[model samples]
Target: MRIAAITRDRPPHTKHTAEVVNANTVVSISFFAAFCPVSSRRFPAIGFERHSDEAKNKGNDFVAWNSLISSFASIGNASGAKNAFDAMPGWTIVSWNALLDAYARKGQQLRRMESLLDAMPEWNVVSWTIMLKAFTKEGQIDSAVAVFDSMQERSLISWTIFLQAYAARSGHLAQARNVFERMPQHDAVSCNVMLVAFAQAADPASAKRVFDSMRQWTDVSWISLLAAFARNGNLEGAKNTFDTSPFRNLLLSTAMLQAFAQSGHIDQAQAFFESMPEWDLVAWNTLLTAFAQAGDLYSALPVFRKMPVKDIVSWTSLLRACSRDPAAASIVFHSMPQRDIVAWTSILEIYSQAGELGAARSTFDRMPELDTICWTAMIFACSRSSAGEQALELYALMQMEGWNPNGVTCLNVLAACAHLGLVDRCQGFLGSMILDHGLSPGIEHISCAIDLLGRMGRLEQAEELLRAMPFSPDAAAIRALLSSSRTHRDVDRARRRARSSCSSLATIPLLSNAML
Candidate 1:
């Protein structure tokens, strides 16, 4: 048993059991003297029986119960886990934790999770931590925080989990700091969690403060801080973080390369890429994504061609970059080994952006699995290309295909109706937004509607919709109406709306290349 446990990587629990049996005189003798079964091999992984009925009956013995439950939980079968827990005539702390963990992981009902805790009759730090994690996953931040404060005993795990919850909520950096300040003990994991939270919350300075406060650090903490800097577009700061680290891992290197790429320092990014002794798929993807973002699709070509092995992400990145340049994108698309849905979607999006409606339609027809994104892209491209009739036809066909049109698809339909002077069609789309689809119109959706109304010379109705909007109008919508009014010879309405837009918001000067 001891050798098998060791081979199976359960040393801690096995050793603990050994100490208990060895400390007892009679139990140790009886344990060895009993009819002990011997296995043919030291460990069983590849050829192990997969829980046959006979094997399961034999596995009801005390030794295998915990392992069985753990194995089931690890595989993510909450139903099977509950069955195992119920089958056990007696329960242990380990078994309870496994069951509760399965529930938390599967995101079962919170009440169901609480029922498991209540049935325990006695609880420990592990049980509380699981509950905290469940609440955090469900976005019940207040409940998670309340549960933490109410715990008579809290550990490093509890503190780290709570801080993570705060960070997940937008603009809650201050809450994370408050939790970190109150923790009785701060370990590397705890510090690293806070750093990641602040970094992702768009506060690199807070992330840095937590990182600097750590008395000792791990590779995780180092990489977390570096990622924060990278996300904030602080290329020099990210580089400095990497240089200061005592140990650098693959993730840090990738982060630094991506940061440099985003900060428009392509040369620095290339330097880091060249310096790596060993490169993984992630490294290649990072470089490809960087070049794609810079609108430099040609640079990714050499990397794509010379890659030893390519995966979905690698192909997707190349295809995404190609979307910006039709000529280059066509070359990449043709050379693909086997195109996935993402590859086709990328090509469709490119044609949409480039106003190649015919090509987009061709790709859409060729796709074996035309998902919602593919349909939406095809329609969106038609709308963008000013082919209102084609876009409307595609929209109707999408519905006929039993695919529910989402907000993005609706927005495009509105754009098509507005551009084509189909006022009745525009009204029908708006009605669907509220009555059929049950989607609350966002600013972008409202903007499309306003553009539609403005184009029809209904300036008064457009202004009313702007005022009636739940959220404030964006600059683009206001400016579109104002500019359209000027073209329609409604100079007074145009000037008034323009002045209101300028005064109501800090409107940036419209770029000359903007589509409007």
Candidate 2:
């Protein structure tokens, strides 16, 4: 049957012309059916399955098989993509690339990608680029560089990806610039990456230099530069860029609105928002954020009511604005049509900050999903309440639930351990942060550890830690050690710490006098 005839009965909107001229080729039908909007959404995998079966019965059409794999991959059905790959009569380079792309998009499957790359019959630029992206996504920038270096030929995309990998890291802008300079070519994307890097570094001068050097300007080019100025609090620069732009789209207009809102020009922001020819959800949210940041709920509420459609950000922004009044925030929280983790966490933080532990715990319990920040917030609340035992219990429960504690969570956990004088537990948590989570203990963590050691009469170990910690002992760390020395009556150690504190410019003269 002709491909057109097969799809002629499909809805007019779903009908697409196929380029394949052969009447017997199943590949065309497979591509059309797999992507046909109506069938893809309504039947999903079923349509692919039917096409695959027909292709198998008619002949072993690798193109049909590859099409099915790609369709499955696009929807993030890695398992389905793999199944189609396994069923393929013959695998082509495209087949391997399709499967690799599926796994890359699935994320956190680096090991699988490695094994697949090793097993591939050969590597192409596409395959290598996919692997480069997978490493970058996983924050393995060094590995991504190694992959880039190993490639005999690098495409502009590969170079851009390599540039972005460096740019994304704080304090690596020099390296990103080096990569950009060395690139065989520069695209709008690579330039924007540098633009954002400088913007985030609060260097609009450098960002503008890069912007001026661009040979061709895209909308993103304009927005990135405008945003750079906005971020640096140069509202005048942002306005000039907006006014001179060849076109004014919603996104560009929203960026200007954000510049005004962020710079505390609320009056300008409101006026600019009103003047916009049309507004997207983002522009509305930006205005709400302005009032929320300024603590002007009186103004924020009206904007919230005026929005045509409310997204999670819209609700969260308003919820944040009502933070001072937990009762009002709670009312808004309950009224939200949908509550995401951010909203739930915000409400929990409000209650926790208000010293309503019962309400905080209740809100935490009611949350359908909990991310690292949410878990950290609740643990912090318990820690601050001096419920050290309860905080430790929650920390244990957080681990049992398979949530890995981040640095902030570790800080709270260490503080609780210190309050309870659990030296052994404190040491273990510190060690695990390094070994399991791969997090180096910040000075705050070390201070808590020192404090715990001192409270438990391990003054010598506390002193040793103070001297041995990679960070120069801060005021808190020294005070923790000195306080413990006084408690333990280690006069010599106290004097040493006092002198050391003065020399380090973290002087605690009152403590030093008390110690003497």
Best by lDDT: 2
Worst 10 residues of 1 by lDDT: 1-10
Which stretches of model 1 miss by more than 4 angstroms?
1-91, 99-186, 324-340, 365-372, 389-410, 422-451, 462-482, 491-516
Task: Give me candidate 1's TM-score against the actual structure.
Answer: 0.68
Q: What are the lDDT figures for the candidates, one per model? A: 0.72, 0.80
Q: After superposition, how far is residue 150 of candidate 1 from its true place, in Å?
A: 9.5
Candidate 2: tens digits of C-alpha lDDT, residues 1-516 = 111221122222312122222322332232233223543533354677687787577455666767677677667678988988887666766777788877876788877876776666556666677777778878988678777887777777778778888999998989998998899888777898898898778777888899999998888778888888989889899899999898789989999999999899999999999999999888899999999888788999999999999899999999989878889989999999998888999999888777778899999998999988898889888988888888889988998989998899999999888888789999999899999999999999999998889888998899998899987888888878877777777888888778777765544653665466
Model 2 CA deviation exceeding 4 Å by range: 1-151, 161-178, 198-209, 229-249, 260-278, 293-296, 450-516
| Candidate 2 lDDT (Cα, 0 to 1) | 0.80
**Backbone clashes counted, model 1:** 0
User: Per-residue lDDT tens digits of candidate 1, residues 1-516?
Assistant: 111211121112221221121112322222132112323212333322365343367543533554555545544557777887676656656666667776775674577776676566355566677777778888877677667766766666677788878866777878878888988888777787788786786567888888888899888787788788878877678889989988867777777777788788887788889998778888888888777766676788788777888887787788777766798788878878878888889888998889888888888888889878888999999898888899999988988989888889888888889888887778778888899878877888888878878778788888888899888788878876775676577766765666677664433343221223
